[model samples]
Target: MKAIVKLVILLFCVTAFSQGQQHVEYKKVSNNLIKATYYFADNSNAIQSEGFFNDKNQLQGMWVSYDTEGNKTIIAYYDKGKKVGVWTYFKDDKINFVTYKDNKLIGVEEKALVVN
Candidate 1:
């Protein structure tokens, strides 16, 4: 029926538009670092993750991740491929701060998410 055909067409269009191609970009920066950026597949092409890597392809420096809604989800750091410094995690109703030293968890703190 025409109604059925229209429904199918609508579904197809919605599916096609909802799907987007994900991509990543890597660029060499000063101090022998490779900056990497990952983008979400949604039509908005929002950033999903970003970080840096050393010349040896080891994770280094600051890294960040975002959710599909472009909200910061995690903030982390590394030193010579070893986890170090404080990392922040954003949850649905709370925030967590985790500290690391030489890739070992040192401390953790959690706080409620407050909205004005």
Candidate 2:
């Protein structure tokens, strides 16, 4: 995990786009925290996104999002709803990493999108 954290992870503003996400669905887990899994609006019943929210309703831990075709679109981390640490974005044959500290972008790296 330490080695992964040291790898490139960088940023793109997701705030405005996620505004409509206010309607996303989440459920309470054994820890009494919310575990959310958004679904594709279509009939595929595929998961569109997934993450956990803290007691204070803040996003925490690893959050993952999938594209319409079921391809992973992004892997992001948050603490108390603030973008922190490494975030990865996936595009056609390209991968972008965004690193953040206290919601501020610290670095960026782009490379071939590798799948294994």
Q: How accurate is candidate 2 locally (lDDT)?
A: 0.82
* TM-scores for every candidate against the unseen true structure: 0.76, 0.71
Candidate 2 ranges with C-alpha deviation above 4 Å:
1-25, 114-116
What is candidate 1's CA lDDT for residue 7? 100
Pairs that clash in candidate 1: none
lDDT of 2 by residue, 1-116 (tens): 86565442312235445543434577888574689988865533678899999998898889999987788999999998899988999989899999999899999999996778
Q: Give one clash count per candidate, in the order shown.
A: 0, 6
Worst 10 residues of 1 by lDDT: 38-47
**Alpha-carbon local distance difference test for all models:** 0.93, 0.82
